[model samples]
Target: MRPGADIQAFMGRLGYEFAQPELLIRALTHGSIATATRPDNQRLEFLGDRVLGLVMAEALFKADKAAQEGQLAPRYNTLVRGETCAAVARDIGLGDVLKLGRSEMMSGGRRKDALLADAMEAVLAAIYLDGGFSAAEQVILRLWATRLASIDDDPRDAKTALQEWAQAHGMQPPAYEQTARSGPDHAPVFHITVRLDDGSMADAKGAGTKRSIEQEAAQKLLSRLEGGQ
Candidate 1:
């Protein structure tokens, strides 16, 4: 494939094309690249976070009219969340296009979920800037429609999954306690501890609702229990 061919293809899948290729480059640039050495994607990521959220909220609100805010919010969080973005980036080969510093490249920054998610957000910002909100909405809906569509009030809940997994194994359900919280009230980093009845425990950190954080902590503990190293 040519240099930006895959990116262009991804945009094609996204139903928008950038007027400026530099916007895409900036989106793919990591903070490890440095502002002095290379203007990184931080500003674009900031813009993207807002744009992505707006697009997602509108889609979710429109799709499930019977769903209340309490029910729809967490599902919305997971669809645009870091893990989902990282999965999409890997799926679309965005990780290979990432421009990282030597240290970051060596340290496996390309595979980092947080970075991938930020890059995805930056890409959304770039699309929005180069095109418009319509473009950004196109990117978001393309990436997130399936995730949003599959959500409901039944077996898909993270808390429910964690509980069922534990119960089936003849163990008590995982216990979650909010260990710490910081940042402004609007943006908090929730630290949650997930403890199994058998004394197994794992601490996971995430920036989102407590339900999301607890799900993360439980997922981590589940991984360790299932013998993931």
Candidate 2:
């Protein structure tokens, strides 16, 4: 699709036409394509991360009136975490509008989980700046509606759940190793493998920080174990 057409279609999906389309442009620009004059979306991603955290925190607080701080904490983390953000981005087709450098584009930057997640947050920040908090909140709540409704009140993160499972079964804790790193430094792809003492293992790939990759890998391994795979 044409870039402009893709952007307009993306705006329709987001349910908010940008008052300042430049903000949306900047949000869709990756660091690889950025120059001294043309800025990237990193700053917006930072702000958006905070915005997402606050919205999720308040949401969890209100949704679980009887939940203690400890109980609500994991749910909040699960909701605002990078993997979750990327999933939302995919659901909303945010990747199609992403502007990437030649190298990144050739290497599947649009499909990278980390880049998509960051762009998703940047888009949120752009909406916040273009409209206001209420507007951003509305978009986030709508986009994340299904996730919010099905969120566990006391969710255990994948890494923690794997560790607990290993301990319970008298196995060593799951070990994660970074198998690969690709794409540009600004939007790197991480490939990780998680292995249990019993030789069961699973591999997962994601974009973003190594820790997030490990968490995803652990989750995959856990799922395999539970499934008797």
- The lDDT of model 1 is 0.78
lDDT by residue (tens digit), candidate 1, 138-225: 7778777677777655424456667877899898888889989987654668999988777888898877567678888877776776
Top-TM-score structure, candidate number: 2
- lDDT per residue, candidate 2, 1-229, as tens digits? 2337778899999999887888999999999999898899999999999998889898888987998988888888889988899999999898888989999988778877889999999999999999999999999999998999998865788899999999999998888888889987766889999998989888989776788789888888888888887
Count backbone overlaps in model 2.
Answer: 1
Q: How does each model score on TM-score?
A: 0.68, 0.80
Worst 10 residues of 1 by lDDT: 151-160
